[model samples]
Target: MTDKIRGSIGPDGPPWPVDLLADLHAGVLEPNRAADVRARVGDDPEARAVLAALDAVRTDLGALRDAPAPPMPDHLAARLDAALAEEARRAFGGAPSRPRPPRPAGRR
Candidate 1:
């Protein structure tokens, strides 16, 4: 996705993670997470549109429930898992190494 279409953070911090969006769309986010998404969407027009689009897609696919979804092949699933792990590692490289504790007045 281009930067414009890519996730954008609202007034808070980083954008809502894709996983949360997926779960929110899937109606499976934990209660607290669901509340957070709702609040964020309420605060951002772009996010509101994204959720609306997801809802539309879900409504359109509602008929497909007649047949159970096909299972993913083990090999394909493993490859996808590995790719996602790699992407996540790249996104959040080795943990923050520096200490972040607030030091007393003038001690550097």
Candidate 2:
């Protein structure tokens, strides 16, 4: 497994971390860094395999969106509800008297 990772390294530096590869595949990487990663992995069979696996996972998760979701078990739902209520009480010092105003949109 480590060897497969090392297989992607170029003369410039160490192997690209799997998380960066995942970000590249997900189109979340900054443009310049994404391009650099692509250039490094373009000819490496191992890196290509990693990218293929990420693609398959993305496809599988997408397919799940169309599938009917299972209902949570009643007991589990009750426990989860209790937990969330407790958290809300702790965080806000009890139930809020009024709903919070919506946050303004856009980056902070």
Candidate 3:
């Protein structure tokens, strides 16, 4: 298991870190590592609590998937478009200062 999975122990509480438990709940860990984490979590009450909270969040988010997303406000959309255009200009050398003459037909 990676260091990220094997979270550090603290004197205060929580044998496993919230992120580690979340990863386990999300099924993002490798099979062997996940099994190890599950075994450890089975014996830890705090870890179980964290997993339960994560499960609730997952259920809520899953429910949202079936619901329609809220529309982006017009003002926010305009701002985002302007930002993206500016970024494109910066990335592609600012859209040629002026339009170039059209190339002759069939020219290489």
Candidate 4:
């Protein structure tokens, strides 16, 4: 996740600003407020760049949301499985009798 945010793997590369997630998330929560924030960002070069990076991230996320699921690396899949197991344990008061498979990739 850090590598992906740092642009080490995906397009947009490292130096891609991750701050856009906050802005985009804000937009998701309150579109009018997001519009106000976006206007402010337009006045600052750095802000604009961050917004652009976020737009790229949003685009990629959207593509994933729209596409079919794909295979995931073993480590990541295992990590997700473990987290879900923890969550399930917390919810159920006991370990999952059996480990469940990882969720499909792509968007939720």
| Regions of candidate 2 where Cα sits further than 4 Å from its true position | 1-14, 75-108
lDDT sort, best first: 3, 2, 1, 4
> If both were scored by lDDT, which would come out higher, candidate 1 or candidate 4?
1
Q: Which residue pairs show backbone clashes in model 2?
A: none
> Candidate 2 at 32: error in angstroms?
2.0
Which consecutive 10 residues in model 1 have the weakest lDDT in total? 99-108
Model number with the top lDDT: 3
Error of 2 at 54 (Å): 0.6
The per-residue C-alpha lDDT of model 2 at residue 84 equals 76
Tell me the lDDT of model 2 at 65: 91
Candidate 1 Cα misplacement greater than 4 A, ranges: 1-14, 64-108
State the C-alpha lDDT per candidate: 0.62, 0.70, 0.70, 0.59
Tell me the lDDT of candidate 1.
Answer: 0.62
lDDT of 4: 0.59
Q: Which scores greater on lDDT, model 2 or model 4? A: 2
TM-score of candidate 1 to 2 decimals = 0.43
Candidate 3 per-residue C-alpha lDDT over 6-91 given as tens digits, one digit per residue, 9 for 90 to 100? 46774124567777777788899989989887886787787888788888988999999999876666556656667777777788
Each candidate's clash count: 0, 0, 0, 3
